[model samples]
Target chain A: MNFDFGFAIVAAVIVVSALFVVRAANLIHAVLWLGVTLLGTAALYAQLNAPFLAGVQVLTYVGGVVTLMIFGVMVTRRHDGIDVVAQTEGADRGFIFASALFVVLALVTWKSAPHVPNPAPVASSADIARALLGEYLIGFEVLSLLLLAAIVGAVVLVRRRDPEPAGEPSPAAAAVSEVNP
Target chain B: MNEFLQGGLYGGGIIVAIMSSLLFVLWTERKMAARMQSRIGPTFTDPLGFLQAPADVLKLLQKEDIIPEKADRALFNNAPLLGATVAIAGAAVVPFSATIVGADLEVGVLYLLAVGALGVLPVFAAGWGSNNKFALLGAMRAIAQSVSYEVPLVLAALVPVILAGSMKLSDIVAYQSSHHWLVVWPFFLGIPAFGLFMLAMLAESNRIPFDIPEAESELVAGITTEYTGMKFGLFYMAEYLHTVIASAVASALFLGGYDGPIAPGLWWMVLKTGLLVVAIYWLRWSLLRFRSDQLMALCWRWLVPSGVVLVVGAAVWVVFAG
Candidate 1:
């Protein structure tokens, strides 16, 4: 069997990193290692001649989404050392079985190396612009609507409500009373 | 096959260089932070502490690995892997140069955005798997910030794509080489979109002035507070790598990437990205972060509308200019 050394290394990294991601005890470390695995995938993309995809890999995935995940960690107020065990205990065995299935699939795919046609290079961003705006305009509009909803949802979710009256005047009112009195 | 592999060595070197550059930027950020606060920066490590980063990385690698007792063993391990892997994989599609691109796929931009979006999973996984309330809170906030800012970011970026008229970054660069850079275009919304894109990019990367996720004062490192040793280092690297990519993309989009009077195309691209990185880092320390509500308001009420107008304006320009 002809072994593609570079592919092997990337595959190994992906597997080991995925394992680490699933097994790590610290939640933050899992996130960080996941970032590593994503980076490796970006490398693979580069090998595939998709530099723009690679850039977006970092820009959107690592840059935007990952940072958001980190932000999520804060708002949730997660305890530093607290570890939450899996809610479903048997999930591990299922994951193992899935991994085996995935491995078999991957091997088959690699061996077949399906004859994909080389894509014709376009002139500029105009092509994508035309596509997104012309043919995909409805999708684009829907995405905009989704964004608007997200904005409204976030604002509504985070706004603080006035608490029920505590015994001796609320904090704001008490402060005002003290200042005026 | 051997020839293809041999050809890939150069590609690997480029990746290594890019990664090393990011590591250098991380060190610069720390030193810059210290300098901004009127503190003596790393001066003890190696010849003026230049080797401090390498030393720090080595130390992290050597540190003992710890697992939280209550953590979901699988997801905990998966989080960092997810984070770093997505970062590196996203880096692949960035066209550093015409000849030196990682990938040249047709849907390069879309693939990039999609793959990059995966970054959120690992982050959420970290908090959810750890069963840590603080981590969970941080992860949620990060998600909120990201999702909100992403719209404006994507919309702002679309201006350049509209102007250049392609999703492939190589095509964009080539267009820039042929025509005057998009910045030179006299559309009314040109500069505003650029500004919005840059600001959104900064927030997207979680740079200072937008680093609410890791607000030291409130969250005590937030999502990453529990992480240590190499685990922390990986997160750190991922962040820096994001910064690098963001800066590069911003430059590529607005600053007429690789188009210049003197230097070679690749060098010019690097220079532009480097300068933008410096600016981003400078702003991180110079400005205070906005409150979450204020930040969200800025994105939705102001940035999104402005970005939409800019995109529409670009479309108008395209119709007229053509």
Candidate 2:
């Protein structure tokens, strides 16, 4: 399949699902829509001849991130159907940020490389791996370090604040109980 | 037919074959589990209980379909179907033999991994949509277990991918057929990686010792507490189908799929998959369920670390030995 037609179809699916993601009233539905959006983006990556990115997109986003998001949503809230998801009007900000980030990424990838803005017709995972580790090793390592820092930060944020008095539940646990109850 | 239609037909064919095979597997599982406890299993339903699975399925079909008054209708009705769909979809990348197969994508191994891991979502949806406390609790445990186990599962599967130097299942099998099954070769790395993969596969499939998500004693029917009739049947069938396809994928990766002396390729593939399926059931019947905390501890404290080590070992073996 040539690029444009596949990209268009996949992009359309991604955009529609992403719209549902932002507009769904139920939190769970929103999360599921996000999964569809990610799966579509993975298809787009496949269409773009970046099969490695497509696999990682499906594996990491659909399998890992989406599951994590659902767990967090389920455990922390009464989100089955009783509570409608929150809404915000910062969608314009999101659009601006996404577009700006896209432009920056496009420039970084296109401007620095051999001036071929057109991606190759086919690139296997091994080719991508060699490039990432050979020419872009520093960038990959730094990104991993950044991910490590974020993970540590999350652990710290969720750590117990202090010891509770005997038989007294921690406030965080208490809040969870109240919400779930 | 167009490619889309052909793909659909192929996928539908695989699903039908797998689901029908589940009848045999279901009987085998019950009889095996019963025999392990020294009891007769399902013999009265038919001769040797061969017809029992189909009879039960028919009974389920005749029962009333139910959606709780408080439940989300769409998700409640569709989650089980989604579960079954994900289970069947993984079959697309499974190379059953040298010739007969599904789409042999370049990234077939990753395709299987992604699809296998996608099984967790339906449980979450079913649990939340049921609007029952038991169901919600089940979904919570499921997500936690699936997420934790999938890390090690993916890492361990990647060991074979590294050793074979490709993500394509066909290539991996070809590599194995030409050299050695991954379960035997590479001296130290292959066996351990295969073992770790099996453990994580059990958790991923929510088989015994890792089936806390559906622990019968505490959670009633767990995620399926609110499901009934054919909807529940779909979930039941999807689960067995998942294990069967998982065994197929495992054999394709580690057991020299479709490659053996004298026998036809399909027979070899089927034989290996059958043995693995029986092995999985054996473990289920032989062991007790694990505590929730113990499951988590097993994944994070041991399996994940071993998975990382195995991946590195495979890669290093490739670098020095390949």
Candidate 3:
């Protein structure tokens, strides 16, 4: 567990999947690549001893967000050729420039940060639960309330219109969201 | 190196055990479903068709692997394998008894939920790759069902974790062996949580009553529409395997796993898991399937709220009583 073999492999997976996410032409494939990237990130979190964080990463990003993204893609009139960003001219120059900028940012942050690749695994689940429930209880509850507000707002904003006057094919596309029940 | 090899071998053994048990699960479902429907089921494969599932699996696998001409090659070829792989991987954290486990992860409960969530990806991938509209629709249904049900499922699972005060499956079991089973203790908290867990389990595994994702009449086998041969077989196996693994988790979380009298701990664990598996099949046969709309409504309107209340109640109970 202390060795870098696992870290290197997981990092490679994350980088490759993220690259594919950017380069994939098909919308669904891109979403799937995003999922793979999220999973790889979760693996890295586990290696860093943030097992709880890793689990939630997979549960929320790969599981919830990505699934919704997939449904969003599928419910659209078309699933393919949705990703044209990678196909347009001048994209390579932009990508290369972005990569270079990202490398520089990584180097700058690496120099300043405390390097604790093998921290003593102090951030266990119990410690987190205690701190959140005891010291930060108010903050946690408030954040939860904020999330609930967001949900309510979204539902209200997108409240379904009354049934289209008879004989119309119906906006069953809206119901396609029911795909994700 | 030696410890690694031993661990690998032990994990391999668990997988083999799970695989073999699938046959028994299949047999029981057949006999049970038949009895429920008042019709005869397979009675010939291996002395009352005991090995009929494996036989059917063999037949399905031997058929020619058919890749649709327009299918996305990479995803179409690999998604079912991924589905089956995820199901087996989730089992790694499940303590079959006091001693047997592939990896007793400290955060085992969360890991199981994560892997369970990962199950949605493969179905969507398969659907997208198939280039078939109905497959897309079915995959969409699966994603929706899993994602929706996952909310209540996680909250319900957390009730046990909250009661035991640990996310480790073995610790949860130990807690139950010493105290009461979480499903029985905490006064009125356990039953609702367990009920919610059972419902979510049915939906998560796409079992009957929640099988709208593969409603045969509607979507032509849903996500497996374009699959043939072993690939199709793999998807079906994954469904059964998901339920089996989920049952193991449920037994560990709710039943007093391995706590029965006059038997080795492993045997009791196996017995409880077997019963839970059969009970799930009974549930599937006894109920009618949910239409996709009703499915969502049931989840959002009933199960999720119940789960939240149960979780809060369990947490409060753990603090005051336990």
TM-score leader? 3
lDDT of each: 0.74, 0.86, 0.85
Native interface contacts kept by each candidate, as a fraction: 0.18, 0.58, 0.91
Q: Which ten residues in a row have the lowest lDDT in candidate 1 chain B?
A: B107-116
| Candidate 3 residue-wise lDDT at B292 | 87
Q: TM-score of each candidate?
A: 0.70, 0.87, 0.90
Sort candidate 3 into its docking category.
medium
lDDT of model 3, residue B60: 91
Clashing pairs in 3: A179-B144, A180-B144, B209-B289
Q: Model 1 off-target regions past 4 Å?
A: A1-181, B1-11
B-chain TM-scores per prediction: 0.94, 0.97, 0.96
> Candidate 3, residue A139: CA error in Å?
4.1
Residue B256 local lDDT, model 1: 72
DockQ, structure candidate 1: 0.15
What i-RMS does each candidate reach, in Å? Answer: 6.7, 1.0, 0.6
Q: Tell me the deviation in Å of residue B286 in model 2.
A: 1.5
